[model samples]
Target: MKKLVVLLSLTVILSACSAQASTNKDSNKDDKEKVSQSSEKKQTSSDVYVPNPQLTDDRSLLEIGQAFKDDKGVSSLKAIKKVNETYRIGDVELIIHDVKVIEHTPSYSMIDYFHGFTHEETFDFVKANIEIKNTSDQPVYFSPIAILESSTGEHRDWEADIYLEELNGELAANGSKKGNVGFILDHSDKEVEWVKIFTSDLLNEEQKVTNKAQEITIEF
Candidate 1:
């Protein structure tokens, strides 16, 4: 009888130890699952790249070479990228980009109050952030870039533009960087409806041909 009693106690102890071990394993699994979930949430929050949208088809920037035709100011066709889908029509080369239309807006700062307002204007300025990927092997300098508006098809005509005046940014060959590109949208010119942008240095001179040249619609 004593032997049977001892055997029963041994069996109970073995079963109890197994139950405790199983409980510990289950607890550890739950802790690991919670930690995994927390880590996943943090990783998701880190991956947001919100680029400005108004960079689509910047016609004005494309025309920087045309508006200011001097060799120095003219953005060389050699310097622009191939993704722009352009061909040489005469001596002019068209540079293009896909811009996100983020703000078709009016100047709402204290600066706008110097004149007077009539109504909520139809976007006088366009602003966008662009990712400039330098596909060339050499680096190039930039001017306070101008935003150009395209008149359809491939033509480098300077449209409504807002000159940045001081654009001395650098780009690494085969590397990528991001910067802002914009245009002065004129409420008066219907040609300024949609825009294209290009960057250039001011030391470059403009080729003088009048028609689609920049007109002072609004000075900001």
Candidate 2:
């Protein structure tokens, strides 16, 4: 009886060791697969173009517009073009609509900007560089990227503001365009999540492309 009991105990231990080894091997394989996938996401070469949204946790929230109804590309811009609709900054239902992507370079595409350098008291200190590209063989221009809004149930369209008005021009067909715009928020009221971009001439009767925006904050 004592010999039989010893044999049984040894068999049980051997079986457990084998099971543990198999589990470890499977886990290691899964980890390697995940690492390979992560590496693939960063492998875009210089010839393939990508746009930039200069965002930071201190001043911005970023979301890819993948759920747009008409998006066809493998990127956020493709999604925005497909959806042909608008979204709210947060739960407040402040609709920002008619989001269009311009082929211009992000450095030059004018958008609603908060000037922090001149008037320190009335603006935000955070600025973003928006880059847009025209991923095609021929040239094209997405002139005046525009969005619409609704106030009191009334429909309105708006554009980005350029202190230099002559800058409102078209991107060449089949080619890419670039532009630079910025925003500045005072440290006291830094909780801005959503912003509206539009073209307006209402400020000085010049009727140029400009921005009319409102601040929506979590704590507000």
lDDT (Cα, 0-100) at 172 in candidate 2: 22
What TM-score should be assigned to candidate 1? 0.30
Candidate 1 residues 1-220, lDDT tens each? 4553343333323323333434444335434434444433122211333332222223334322322222112221101221322222112222233332222232334224312322433333344433333334543222222324443322221222232211223332333333444443334333333343433321111212111212111111
Off by over 4 Å in 1: 1-97, 100-122, 127-129, 135-138, 143-168, 189-220
Residue 18 in candidate 1, Cα distance off native in Å: 75
TM-score for all models, in order of appearance: 0.30, 0.26
Q: What lDDT would each prediction earn against the true structure?
A: 0.30, 0.25
